[model samples]
Target chain A: MTDAYSSSRLVAGVRTGQQRSIARMISRIELGAPGVDLELAELYGSAGRAHVVGVTGAPGSGKSSLVSALAASLRRDGKLVGILAVDPSSPFSGGALLGDRIRMSDHSGDGGVYIRSMATRGALGGLARATTDAITVLDAAGMELVLVETVGVGQAEVDIVRTAHTTLVVSIPGTGDEIQTIKAGVLEIADIHVVNKADRDGANRIIRDLTGMLRLGPPTPPGEWRAPVLGTVATEGRGIDALAAALHEHYAFLAAGDGLEQRERAMASARVSAIAQNLVAERLTDSGLGDRAAQILDEVYHRTLDPFSAATALVRVTT
Target chain B: MTDAYSSSRLVAGVRTGQQRSIARMISRIELGAPGVDLELAELYGSAGRAHVVGVTGAPGSGKSSLVSALAASLRRDGKLVGILAVDPSSPFSGGALLGDRIRMSDHSGDGGVYIRSMATRGALGGLARATTDAITVLDAAGMELVLVETVGVGQAEVDIVRTAHTTLVVSIPGTGDEIQTIKAGVLEIADIHVVNKADRDGANRIIRDLTGMLRLGPPTPPGEWRAPVLGTVATEGRGIDALAAALHEHYAFLAAGDGLEQRERAMASARVSAIAQNLVAERLTDSGLGDRAAQILDEVYHRTLDPFSAATALVRVTT
Candidate 1:
């Protein structure tokens, strides 16, 4: 079949919420296969309907289990849910996804929930871009809600969380060194805080500390939302209902004001910049600019021209 | 003075190893002041002499203390040193640099050692590129050894360490779960492993664990170097000499083969790509393309155009 015909059929399948087509489309997007951008463009108009929520924490914070519990709860609510587990540090192991899949097998045969894992096989920027695309795929596939779970609290993970409408920062008791956690800047981004493993010792203290820290933060403007700290034993499914209710409430809060539109615009701008960067870099290696790029790179390697200057010259050449 | 004349004077000062001039140049580089590219282009020919080493670890791993000890040892051996302490998570509480400075005051009056702390106030990619520029400034200023210290084990930190000729991964006892540490991908990048605070209990076991992990890694070619795990009581000045020796030996191993040249070429390509991306983004904002770019972004915002498709159109227009 022609590429156009195949891509159109895939797009139609995604619109009808076909699972096989969704998975195949995501694979193509991640690989940057030819003509995928056209497919994405056709599907893009159908997005902006799914609520994207990001869950992030350090390892051992029970992020996976919490995400699983949340997904189960959402499923019970009659909402079609999609989960994307992003592991940026799993360059070697590649096993995090498998373990998560096994844990999420309870929803295997159900069409109401879809689970997928994304690992970093190349640049962090590329992984993030691919993630944005994959979310679009799931969103186009009629998923009412998409959950993004990142394994570490580094800058890359933080960037991923910024894509979500509501972000949850998960913490557990007795991780050692309170100072490091504070310094990580997690407090600034969370729309909600989940103290997982509440059955463990020190859970109450952590909850109180987070509440105090939120109080100490800058005062919220009138009509703005304030993040709430809650405790949960995710394994036992305790507090899952409250967490699910909070998500709905937060979505309503955003929809009540201009916050939703503002966030969508911001996310759109970020996406444009990332894609523009990739295009510019690829253009340099294209047929017309390839020889000049090589020459410029050689000069940079030999120190005859600095990198910034070479970049300036290359941009000028393109224009 | 005219910009050209003043920039020339600054370059001359840097070549003569004037600390004040070096500081000013690095500030200009970091802030990306106007005309800094020309200055760097002129100074680039004088670099490629400094031996760049990277030290990275998790927070509370005593990386700063170990770095200070290593710097003092390098000074004792009559080497001019420059240290860049990179903190990618310090979005708020810029206090990390202040605390680090207080601890590093021992070298305050020493003309042979220079220390600086870099925090993330913008994109992680921008910080990494600025770091590469700062390293070049120090190299042009006649520093014989430059050390880069990072406080996290994320992908961003890993990318920063890849710029170094030799990378040392620091570890400490009682940092909690061994599985999390191992999953961080720190083991694959180490040229040497240091178990800081060796006087503490379980230091030996940590060292043994690192050594065993290294042994289980891929076998080295006959002439290739194998990383060694050592214990260090950094606060007491114990084992600093051995760590310094390992660094020198690793550099020599690289210099003995094509490793040094290969690494330099790879670094050059990365710098070029980063600079090129920045230039392309900037060009899209220039007079000719700015209005068109805004229109395209608006279309993307309204879901009339996908970001990838918009980017492709922008690149085509630029060419």
Candidate 2:
């Protein structure tokens, strides 16, 4: 496969909803292959049609099962669904395990449902960019609904979840003070909160606690949508319909006012800024200023030059 | 207390190990005050003398108790200790809770121990910069040992932990499958791993799991230090002495060859790059190019401009 030939064919196949092409494009983006930029430019027009939904929670929150159930529900509504599971886990365990595959097996042979798992490779910021690009690819491939799942570990993961049009934060019962950690950063980003494993003990208390926390915050504006907490036993397919309905409700809310447009604008600004920063860093390295930067870093490390001054100098030289 | 006078006085007092001055300086850094660059430049020389240690773990892992225990043990050896706890939790809580303060009350009014907690107040990346600056301030204040503690949530938190000379990753027993989450990213960064709450069941299993995982990788070089997995019951101060000894041994290992220098150089490079990126972002915003950037973002959002091209253009203009 020649580079030019494959690139053009991949773009065409992706536009027509070919699974192999979509996977290939995502792989290229993940690997940071040459000329992927041009391919992305060609496909950019086809994106912005799919609704990107981000699902996030701690490990063992049963988010995988919840996501699979949600996807099945969306498929029942005749929507073409694409799922991107962002695994920040180590490379030793490549992709999803057998259990995850079995959980998502219902959609395996369905042409309308596509699933891909992405591992955290390279820098953390790069992972975010890759995930965003993957979402774009899915969106461009004519999927009406796209699901992005990630574990909430730190700020970076939370930021990734924030990029979605609607974010579902999943949690389980009996987590104890673990909810406190979620309240700190993750809760604020959620458009819909899910208490998965609702059959487990303390589920109602978890919901009540979340509601109380929500109440303690400043009141929502009259027209703005408030995040609704839902319960689900994902394995039993309980509450999946209500969860899907809530997702649609939030999406409608975003589309009603300038909310959706505003979010898109903010996301675009962030994306551009991230890309520009990476480019600046790469430019500095590629332009032979890396050695100079290293020298200044040494000076800063040895206390001969202050970091602020060293940074200023490096920026001047690189720019 | 004019600006110039206070800045100079703050530097002088910090150099002399004054607690009030250190607090004020950290406050200025966290708030992104105008004159902090000058203050930092003056204090840079006094740094590079303290051995910086970072403690990180998931919330509810007893990291606070572990840190406190380690600090007390270090103090027993006649070393002054400074502690900076980076709380990614929200601002409504306002620093450490009374419970946390009570936990460390044994060191209260002790001049040799200084503890300050930092909350995430402003931008995400800003927290990392402020944390690094706070470390510098503490180092300049004649502290022989400094502990930088943070909750492991996402990549940003992990990056902050990596800045330390020795990073201790704390975990509790029976965290089943949660350790799998840890293996993805955090395990690779640990200089020493502590399974706190050693009296609990499954502590040995967790240790065996970690050791087995470590053995699956290639053999460590002869001179390089292998990350040690230790068990601790931090609340009871069990294994505190051994933990402290391991820390000292790691410090010696770092100081033996060019290991310490190499780490310092890498940290310095990262610091400079971060500051430079921030400066570029600030400069772009301050010079009226922010509006232009936003306009480009708007175009990208509307799909009139591709993000890649927009980013390239923005980089060209800013650089």
Candidate 3:
């Protein structure tokens, strides 16, 4: 697998939508194995054709179920789909239960669908980088649509929104009102608002509240896209078609003018900066700079050198 | 105020515990104004004396009330305290409700306590940096104790825990379950577990669950500390003394045998790395390198260059 011949074969296999090759490529990327970059470079040209959709909501909001149903709907349209479930690796949340995989098991034999879960294994910005790379692989693998699902927690949600072309913010009724959802910072990143489990009590009230809040919130420019609140009962696959239509509508909106181009540029810029930072950090750690850092830290601890001066010196020496 | 004389005077005033100077200094730091770094340098020597404590919990968990009660108890022991309330600035949360401030109004005129709220204003890593600088200011202001309270959500909570010497994870009965708390990522970072609103049903159950999880989860090295769960009813002020005692005991444990020294060095290393990264990012953005990045991104977008190669080139050019 480390030889040039094997690498080229892997890339060729991935470009032809071979499941085994695609899985192998993704696994190598996730493990940060050597020589994967060459493979990515070979397959990178085949990407940029898939529409990436991000689905995020608080825990227990049925995000996985909703994403499963959404994938099924996309498949029904004779489209190839890829699903990436981002887990935060929370021990108590049962994020490791493989619930999303189980729910989508029906698509296992379809050959038109692919599913994978990515976890944040204590790497700074590593998950985001792996996710972006995985999306590229899936896109190159001939998937027309890719759904990225994540729990609405911390910086992960923000990163997902930045990476995806369209983002859906999911919520449920009786989840501590509109205020709690807003405080989670997911509302601001939402391109489309979804009230899942719409059959439950207070569903109408939540929709009304969300609508009113959006109205009073930041003013949308004329001719700009306005996020619409939609209701869904994902368990029974209700509203899946409407949701799919809304996604397409959003995509059309992006393609209308310079929106898609500008968005792609912005995303690229973000990715570049993130990778630059990670690379610098990695270089510093891989070299003997840790000892120098410790020495400076000791000086700072002993009040012999201030943190600002120490940091400036460290940056100067390392960069 | 940007001149050296005024900067020295400001530093002196803060060192002498002047409220006006402390407020002004913190405001300047939060704004990231010029000359604040010099002020920080001048005051950095006096900052290591204060015992910094972090209090974090989910929304509607009575975290503010618990912090208020804890502050009163600390003041009763003849210690000057500074309180920093971190608001995530969710427009719907009504962060300006003065809810936490109102609860601590009893100490408003005490002159021994100072409370201020910090809000995230769309800055990358800005909130954490500002919060850390604010703690330095408060520490130099002769505060014997400083309480940093933030909502336990996302990366912000992780940042708070990393910056503080002792961290208290707050929870409430009937809010959810032990798994939910663990999912928040605060469980692993906690130095102390606080179940506020303990009079509610299921408080004991939560304690039992936490205890069981800790027992089965990880093995603590001999002489190292293990987190202990404590119950409290903040409104009634029950268990306040015990909580305070636990905090002191934790402080003693850290102070014994180079523990505090090791922690301080680790913190300094973390801060230096963060500052170095921020400086590199700022330099790249200010150097007209964004256009170069966009050019590379355009190549990547058109499949002329792969993201890995483009990112490597960008990092090379920028750094």
Best by lDDT: 1
Interface RMSD of 1: 3.7
Q: On DockQ, who's better, 2 or 3?
A: 2
Candidate 1 lDDT over residue span B119-153, tens digit each: 76545476778788889989999999999998777
Task: List the global CA lDDT of all models.
Answer: 0.81, 0.79, 0.78
Candidate 1 lDDT, tens digit per residue, A1-319?
Answer: 2378898999999889999989888878767788888888889999989999999876678888888889899989899999999877665454556368665686788888888887665554776788899999999999999999998777788888888899999888877533455677877889988989999898899899988988887888899999988899998999988999999999999999998888888788778777777765565543435666778877887888888777766654123
Error of 1 at A50 (Å): 0.5
Deviation of model 3 at A139, angstroms: 2.2
Q: Find the candidate with the highest DockQ and give its number.
A: 1
Individual DockQ of the candidates?
Answer: 0.41, 0.39, 0.35
By descending lDDT, how would the candidates be arranged? 1, 2, 3
Order of models, best TM-score first? 2, 3, 1
lDDT by residue for model 2 (B1-319), tens: 3389877998999999999999899988878888998899889878988899988877678888899999889999999999988865443233564346765587987899999887766554677788888999999999998999886545666778888899988878886534653655577788898888989999898888787877888989899899999999988999999999999999999999899988888777677767766765564442435566667767888888988888777654112
Which candidate model has the greater DockQ, 1 or 2?
1
Query: Candidate 1 — what's its lDDT?
Result: 0.81
TM-score attained by model 2: 0.89
Expressed as tens digits, the lDDT of each residue in A158-205 for candidate 3 is 675569899898888986635556676668788899999999999999
Better of 1 and 3 by lDDT: 1
* Model 1: per-residue Cα lDDT at residue B309: 79
